[model samples]
Target: MTDLKFGGYQGDKSVHTRGGRVLAEALAKETDGALTLAFDESIVSRGHKAADLLSMTESGELDGCYFSSSYLAKRVPELGLFDQHFAVPDRRRAYVLLDGTLGYRLREEVAKATGYEVLGYWDNGLRHITSAVSIKSLADCDGLKLRTLANEDHQRVFRALGFDPQAIDVRDLPEAVKTGRVDAQENPLTNTLNFGIHETHRHILLTRHLLGVALVLFNAERLATLDPDQRAGLQRAVDHATQAQRRFAEGDDAICSTELTAQGVEITELDADTRAAFVAAAKPEVEITRQNFSAELRDLFDKELSAA
Candidate 1:
C-alpha cells in the first residue's frame, strides 16, 4: 500500500480541508486500500505561506493540494480568465463553464504548463469586500488601501475601481486586518468569518466582485507512477470530493452571513445603480486584460460563457 500526502492552507473546518478528508476516504475505498491519503489540514500552521502550496506541489514536496486559481494566473495565463471581475455573474453559471469545455481545455493547458494534473474545481466562494468603513458607492473606494491576491489582473481591476490594492498572502491576512495595515480586504464571507476578519472589519460590502475557484492539483510525475487502476480510482475520489465541496461552499455563504450579522457586523447589499457603476468602472481594465489572452482561449471563453 502507498500513502500519499495532501496539504491545505485553511483550517480543518474549512471546505477545502473537509473536501480533502472526503477525498482521503473515497480514495482508500476506491483503491481497496492499495492507495491511501494523509491530509495536512493547515500547512499555514506549519510556518508556510498559503501561496507556497503551488511551488510545494510542483516540486513534489506535497503530493497534492487545492489552491486558488489566482495565484497560478501569472504562470498559467489561461487561468486569468477566472480573474476577471464580474465576468461570471454567479456560482451556478461559473460552475457550468468550469465543468464544461472551457475547464477541460484549461486543465490540459495547466498540466502542460506546470506538470500538475488538475483533478477538480472546488468553489472558493463569491468574494466580497469587508472594510473598516462602509462602502456604498464608487467614490467610497477611492484611496482605500485594499488587500487582494497577488494577481496582476485582480490588482488592475481593483485599481480601476478606485482602490489602492496590495497583495497579501492568506497566512498574514488576519494580522493585517487587526493592525489596520489595509483599510479593506475582499474574500468570501466564510473566509471573512473563519479568518476573523469580520471581528476587526465591521462592515461587509456585498461586492460579489469575483467568484473564486480552487483547483485540486496533484503532482503529475507522482500520478504517472500510479498503476491504471490507482489513477482511475484517484479520479473517482476527486469527483466525489468535488461534489461535496461545492455543496458545502454553496451553503457556507448563507451561514457565514447570518453569523456575521449576529456578531454585529454591518452587511451592505448594493443597489442596482451602485453595482452597475462598479461594473462600468472596471470594464476597461477587464477588456485590456482579456486582450492578453490567446485567441483560442478567448474564443473558448466567449462560447462557454454564452452557453452558460
Candidate 2:
C-alpha cells in the first residue's frame, strides 16, 4: 500500500481533499488495498511545510501531499513569485502561464533544491474580494480592514493598496469578520466556500486579485525505488487524478458563483474604470515579481511556453 499523508482543514472538501482523495483512491484500487493513505489535517499548513513531508516520504514515514504554492514564498521567494499582486483573470489563463512557463521551471528547481517530485499541476483559480461592504474599485479599498495570508508579500501588497490588513491565521477570519474586526478579505472560490466564508459576507466582488496553485509532490528517492510497473502505476494514477483536479476546481468555480449568490451575497464584476485603477495599483508589484524571477530560467521559460 502507498501511504499518503496530506494537509488541509479537516472539513475542507475543496482541492486538498477533493484532489488528494482521487489519487488516494486510485492508488488503493490499483494496488488492490496493498496501498493505504494517511492524510494530515492541519491548518496554518502551507506549501513549504510539505518539504518535510516529502523527506519523510523518502524515509518511509509518509508518501505525498497536496502542497500550497503561496506558503513556499517565505523560504524560496521565487516559488511564491507568481502569486504576487495583480490578477491573472481566470484559472484557464493562469494555468497557461503556471503549467506552461512557471510550472516547468518550478518543478526543476524544487527537484534540484529540495529533492521533491512535482506530481501534477492544479491551479485553484483567481481570488475575489468577499466583504461586508460593496467594493467597486481601488477607492473602496481604502481604510478597510482586509484579511490576508500572514505572509510578508501579501500583507505588503494590501497595505500598499491602502487597506489596513490584519495578519491573523485564516482559521480566525470568519470570527474576525463577524466581530467587525475585518470588513473584507481575498481568497479563491474553492477555499472561501470550503471555509464557509459566504455565511458572513454579503458581497463577492469579482477581482481576480491572485491565483492559488497546489503542487502534489512526492519524495524523490521513494519514487525512484518503485519498480517500473509500480512507477508506471503511480504515474497513471496521477495522470487520471490531474483531470479530476481540473474538474473539481472548475466545477467549484461555477458552484461558488451560484451558491454565494443564492445565499444572498451581492456578486458583481468590477467596472472597466475600477478595473483599470486596480490594475494600475498592482502593476509595479507584479513587475517586481517578474523582475525577481531567475533571469536565465525566465528566458528559457519564455521561449518554451511560447512554443507550447
Candidate 3:
C-alpha cells in the first residue's frame, strides 16, 4: 500500500519515459491494486541532475531511478567494463551478454558497491559520433575536440582515437557545441535529436561504436521492505518494461537516419574497413580496462561475448 516514486531524466517522447510508464502500470496490475506509484519525467525540474539521482536514492529521498550505466561506473569503476568501445556490436549480441551470466554477476557486484539493486537494463541503443565536420575516414577524426561522457573509459577511448575529448554535461551540450567549446560529440541517434545536438552538429557518422544501457535501479533497502509477493511482482514489472523499451530503441535506430537527414544533418554510414580501423584503435583500451577493473567479470564478459 506504500506509494513508490520513480524518476527519469528522459523527456516525454523517450523510451526511458515509456519504460517507466510500463513499469508503473504493470506493477499496479501485478500488485492487484495494492500499490501506488508516481512517475516524474526529467527530475532536472526539481534541480536534481542525473548523477545526483543515485545519491538521492541512497539517501531515501528517491525510491528509484533510471540512468546510463556509465554514470554509475563513475562511482564504481568495475562497471566501466561495459563502456569499452565496440563492446557489443549489434542489438542481438547485446541481449546475449546482458541477459546472460555476465550481466547477472556484474549486477551483483554493482549492488554491493552501490546500495541499489539493478532491476533491468534498458537499451540506450548504439552510440555514433556527431560532429561539426564530416568524418569519411579514420583520418577525419584527427585533432577533433569531442564532447564525451565524464567516465574515464569513454574519455580514454576517444583519446586513443587521436581526438581531444572534453566531458560535458548533457544539459550543457547544446551551448557547448554552439560556442565551439567542443567540435563533436557522440550519442545514440535518439539522444542527439532529443537533446537538440543534431541541430548544432550537422555531420553524424554511423560508427555504431558503443552500445549503452540505462540501468533501472531501486534502493536495495527499500526493495527489501516489500513483501515477497510484492518483490516478485516488482521484478516482473521491470522485466516486462525492459523488453518494451528494447523494442522502442531498435525501432528508433532504424528511423533515425532518415529523420536526421530530413533535418539537414548529413549522415554517413561507416564502411566496414573504416569501422574496423576505429575498432583497432580502441582495442588497446580494453586490456587497460580489464587490468584496472574487476578482472574476473571482464574475463567472463570476454568469454561469453566471444562465444556468442
Q: Which candidate tops TM-score?
A: 1
Please report how far candidate 2 places residue 71 from its true position, in Å. Answer: 0.7
Give the per-residue lDDT digits (tens) of candidate 2, residues 1-308: 55655444424566557677778778777666655556665533543332354345546555666656665566555676557666444556566766565777788877776756887776656788888888877778899999887566777677767788887666577678778888888887766776777778788888877777777778787788777777777767776777788888778888888887787878889888887887787777666666656887656545654554
State the lDDT of candidate 3 residue by residue for 144-253, as single tens digits: 99999878888888888988999887767778988889999999999888888888899999888888888888988999899999898888889989999999898887
**What C-alpha lDDT values do all the predictions have?**
0.92, 0.70, 0.84
Question: Cα deviation of 245 in candidate 3 (Å)?
Answer: 0.6
Better of 1 and 3 by lDDT: 1
Candidate 2 lDDT for residue 24? 70
Ranking by lDDT: 1, 3, 2
Q: TM-score for all predictions?
A: 0.98, 0.84, 0.95
Ranking of candidates on TM-score, top first: 1, 3, 2
RMSD of each: 0.8, 3.6, 1.5
The TM-score of predicted model 2 comes to 0.84
Model 1, stretches more than 4 Å misplaced? none
User: Which numbered prediction scores highest in lDDT against the true structure?
Assistant: 1
